[model samples]
Target chain A: MNWKEFFKNLKTEEQGCVPDETRREFLKIGLIITGVAAGGSLLNVVSVVAEGLATSEELSKEYPYKPHYSMVFRVDRCIDCERCVEACRQTNNVPEYGWRTKILERVDTKAVDQQRQFMPILCNHCNNPPCVRACPTQATYKDKQTGIVKMASYKCIGCKSCMSACPYDARYFNEEKRAIDKCDFCWESRLSKGMKNTACAEACPAGVRIFGDLSDPNSEVYKIVHQMGKAVWVLKPETGAKPNVFYTIG
Target chain B: MKRIIILASTLILGLSGFVLSEITEEGVKYQESEEAGGLEIIYTKPVKGVLFSHKLHVKELGLPCESCHTAIFEMEAFKSQRNPDFIMDSLYKGKYCGACHNGQTAFASNTKCATCHVGVKGLERLKKKAQVLEKK
Candidate 1:
């Protein structure tokens, strides 16, 4: 049968194939059903497309092909000097008991032979952040433009959910301020300085912390991680936080 | 009839996407056990020798994640060394093996053979299954 005739075979004359009153009733039902289906499909398509576009934009911001900069921490180079920690603490005026950044010491004193090794701990600024998930308010978010995991203190209801949920213990609650505080990657200062920079990284005497864009292959942080032959590691990876901070150990 | 075709195609596409993402997310991880227990030393004249340790470095050292590579390393295809010298140059310049044994951060570059090659005899035997892994 021809294509038109083949399609026409799907309907009976009484089932709206003809222009009679009964046919008109069938036609209306069929048209309404068909229209509803088409409209539903169109709406779904538009919503999915919009979601995909938003996701793409967000991914670009987080995992940019070339960001303005990023951060790298050389775990081996860290001396537990607390210079970076103190710098960040004082610069941001972090709470007395709560630290914005800290040094993680991996002491194997039980070994008896090897000297106690120390690993400084702080926010890894992960690529896939768990802290963002723990927050009920979506207060904790990662900025794609700067690649910084930011905490909206105003939106934060001082819930310690993020603090407890974060494996890195990077989140700290400012009891006095009655809000959550975490690393902002020195974003405000960097913007004012017209370049991406971190106060802790700048104050590091051992040059343990290097901050720049990892997306740009030529950038210092990227080169150090990719080409400079440094052994980079992230902390508490079992938590499944894909951190952006790279630590090179000798 | 048209609806059926659309639904079927959508289901197939969605399933394929999920499967592909799963594979991409959890790619192949090469972990060495005492099963491949022999030591292989690839050498360079006038430079130094490269010692491959199975039990000590990989199984021990207790290296954590992102310690050696970035996050995307888990999701990408492996590139081959186009030239022999390319691989050699990487070792010489400290890209992979040079990353640790450059004589500074990890082990010193010496003509000595036993530095990395000498495995804990008990560890090696246990890896060989001649002895069992001890629960220390």
Candidate 2:
């Protein structure tokens, strides 16, 4: 079927939230152009063409990273062991007062089965990272190669803007490193040396933390996120950060 | 005079209750058997408020004391954590709790973390219960 026909069907299917006349007309035209360029397939054309058109229209825009490094916390599995925290400290030489990663305990006496759960959190490495924008010196920037949010320690002036701007409370001032420090998925200490996973993920006795390339379909992170009916969600999604870090119960 | 004496006694009782609540014994001395039931181990090193329950392991699972004592863990409650190598890395390498919890013999240590890791909050809850029981 043609892109117009497919969109018309989709519009009908989504009767609950109908778009305005102008938006419908715009979508119809956009789809037609996308269909012609992509050699339209009736089966997967809608999603494929939609994404292709959006990205292609913005010539300056590009995929965040080839590997798109991400992490997922199976929150239900975290035991509050703090092994990941310990490993991150040892691996990165994180000082005693500050932490690059941490486990937040949630307790609800009213809940059935397990009332207590530990949530392991770190730098989300957001696609639209607020920390990157907040940095006056551009000290903290998202790495173009792997999409990992990295710190250029030398550039940091201890402004703490990135620290305050971060919704996840991930960044901290390090007297030792002489800059704002946060989890870079162990990029400098481990990935730079060709290690596959972060120290936290490696140290977790329970498979609580799954770190891998979100861009690679074969990676476990992709499978867990892309699975149908799985409730995968990111932290502070309302902030428009589009975090690479995801969380799920199962 | 009688009303003042009554008020003084009541004040003394309230003060004594407060003092008793504040008093807590430092360091749990390891013992083979006690009236309070099995041991409740709390590890302070590396991190705070990690708990291991002997009651669940022994009573619920029907595992004998020899299953862990003197082998995987020493007789002392917090002795294992005293060693610098007594971390989760050792567990992943099939040491300490990993020998049984390696996903084969038992639920893998990497799975169901809350099952054992009752964090600082859990540890405090257990300690409070112990104190109440001790008072009784």
Which structure among the candidates has the greatest DockQ? 2
Error of 1 at B121 (Å): 37
Q: What is the lDDT of residue A26 in candidate 2?
A: 45
Residues A106-190 of candidate 1: C-alpha lDDT, one tens digit per residue: 4333664433343555666766666788789988888756657887777989777877667566777788778888877776545
What would the per-residue lDDT of candidate 2 be over residues A59-132, giving only the tens digit for each residue?
11333586778888888877776788889999999999999998777666687644567777788888878889
Question: Global CA lDDT of candidate 1, please?
Answer: 0.51
* Tens digit of per-residue lDDT, candidate 2, span B80-131: 7778887778888899999898989987876666766786556566667656
TM-score (chain A) of candidate 2? 0.76
The per-model DockQ list reads 0.02, 0.32
- Candidate 1 chain B worst ten-residue window by lDDT: B20-29
